[model samples]
Target: MSKNRFFACIRSSFFSRLLMGVVAAAITGTACAAGEAWPKEINLGYQKYGPLIILKSTGELEKRLKEHGVTVNWAEFQFGPPMLEALNAGSLDFAVTGETPPVAAQAAKGSPLVYVASEPASPQGEGIVVKADSELKTIADLKGKKVAVAKGSNAHFFLIQALAKAGLTLDDISVAYLAPADARAALERGDVAAWSIWDYFYAAAEIQLGVRALANGEGIVNNYAFYTSRRDFVEQYPALIDVVLDEVRKTDQWVKNNPVEASEKLAAHVSIDAKILEKALRRSNYGPEPLKPEVTAAQQKIADTLLAIKLLPYQINVQDAVWQPKGK
Candidate 1:
C-alpha cells in the first residue's frame, strides 16, 4: 500500500474512537505544565515493528508532542537488547522491547529502568526455525547441534525454554550468539542447525529463506512486548510518558483496523516484502496496556526462569522496576 492509502485508511470510525479515547485518557494532567521545563527533545528507540513503524511513518508522535515544544527523535535498532542498552545509557528516554531484555537489563549493574506499559501477548510472533531439509525435526534433536540466536534477546529466552521443555539444556547444544542478520546467514549456509528469532525477520526467513518453524512461543513463552523508560526520566516527566503511551494506544487500534496497509507501511520502513510483513503483523497484538499485577507476575516469572538457568547474576524482584503512576 502507498503512503496515501495508509493515511486514507485512518479516516474511519475505529480511528475516530481511538483518538477520542486517547484524548480522554490524556486530558487529566498528561501534558507538560506551562512553565515546567519540558525536555527540548525526547528520544524514542524502536525496532521495525507495527506500532513504532506506523507511528514513525505517519509522523504522528512528532505532531502530537509539537504543541508542547518537544521534538521527537527516532533511532532504529536491530533488536531489543541494544535498544534497552541505549535506554539505560540515557541516549533514549523511551523504548519498546520483548520480555527478556528487561530481565537482562535489570540483571546488569548500573542499568536502572522501569516498565511503564506493555503490548499484549504475541505468542506467534517468534519461534525456532530450521532449513526444510534439516534433520532437526524436534527440540530434542537440537542436542549436539549448532543453534543461532541473538544473545540477551527475547529469542534467547525462547531457545532456553524450548531446550528445557525438551529435557535438554544449553550445554546440550553448540550455541552460536549472532544477531538476526548473521544468524540468518549462518542458517542459510548450513553453519547452524537451527535459528531462534522473532518477526519480521522470522517471517522473512520462512518466506524467503525456505525455513520451517519447528516450534513457536505458543504454550512456551508469553512473548509480551514491553515499553520501558529510564527510571529518572519517568520520574521527571510522567506526563510525557503518559502522552507517549496515549499515542501508542491510538496507533495500536489504527494498525488492527488496517493490517494490510499497516503491513505495507512497515514493509517500506524495514525494506521487507509486504507479504512477509503481513504474515507477522496479522498474528501480533498491539496496544499499551498498564503494568498491572498480572503483567508484573508474568514478568516476574520470566525473571525467575532466567535466574534458574543462571543467566542472571542474582535474583531480582521484577516489581522493583515497575512504574507506579500517581494516585494508582
Candidate 2:
C-alpha cells in the first residue's frame, strides 16, 4: 500500500521476467546445438552392383546405420556416373560409383567428393564381352564390328583398353552406345557382336547367352565401385563415416567368404539371374581397401584415358578430390 513497497514489488517482477527470458534463450540455444529431433537419414546411391545390391537386400547396411539413429535411404541409379551426379547435386549423402565418374563429377561439381572405400576389381574382370558363338575374340576383332557398351562407363574404358591392347583404337570399333539393358539385348540378338560390361550382366550373357570374356580389365583397368561421401559430410560427422567404412569392411568380407549364398542374396536386386551371379561371383574381388596412391593412380589413369579419348571436358585434380582414409 505504501509507495516504496509498490516500487519494490514492481522491480522484483521485472527482474524475475528478465531472468526467465535468459533461461528460455539458453534452452533455445541448446536445442539448436543438439540438432533437430530425428537423426539424419543417409541417402545412399547404388547401381545394382552385387555387393551393393547384397548390402541393401540383406538389410545389413540398414541394420548397421540404425545403430547411429541414421536411417538408410537407398537410391538406385542406372550407372556410376549418375550415382555420383546425385551425390554432387546434394540428393545423396553417399553413393557407389566407379573410379572414373567421381573424377569427372568432381571436376564438374568442384565439390570435394572423396572415396571412402572401394571394392577391388573382379579377378576375372570386365571387358568387351561377346557371344560365345560370335567371332569377335579380341579388340582387333572389334574393328568394324559393332560393340555395345555404356557410354562414359567404365565399360567404355575397358573397350578403349581392349582396343589399345589389341593394336586398334576407339575409332576402329563401331561403338553401339547403349544402356546396360539394351546392350544385353543387342549382344543376344547379335545386333552387336560384342558387349562391354561388368559383374552380373557380364556373367549372365556368359551363362545364358553363351558370351565369352574377350579381355580381362581386372589387372588392367576398368570400373571398380567406390563408396564415396562429401568432404563436408566427413568434417561434420567424422564418426559416421568411420561407421560406414567399418560396415563396408564387414560386408566385403562376408561377400568374399560365402560366394554361392551371396550370389543368391543378390539375385532379387540385379537384372541377371542368380546362376549368372554365381558364375560372376568368382570374378569379383569384394575386399575393400581404403583409397591408396596406387588405387588413385589407377583411377587417374582412367580419367586421363577419358580425357585423351575426349569423353571428359578436361582432366581433374584427383588427388585433391580424394579423402584420406581414416585408418592411416
Each model's lDDT? 0.88, 0.74
The C-alpha RMSD of each candidate to the native structure, in angstroms, is: 15.0, 4.1
**Model 1 misplaced regions, further than 4 Å:** 1-37
lDDT of 2 at 262: 78
Candidate 1 lDDT trough over 10 residues, lowest sum: 28-37
TM-scores of all candidate predictions against the true structure: 0.88, 0.84
Off by over 4 Å in 2: 1-39, 268-272, 325-328
Worst ten in a row by lDDT for model 2: 30-39
lDDT of 2 by residue, 174-206 (tens): 888898899998777879888888766677667
lDDT of 1 at 262: 86
Candidate 1 yields a Cα-based lDDT of 0.88
lDDT per residue, candidate 1, 92-168, as tens digits? 99999999999889877887789999899999999899999987789999999999999989999999999999999
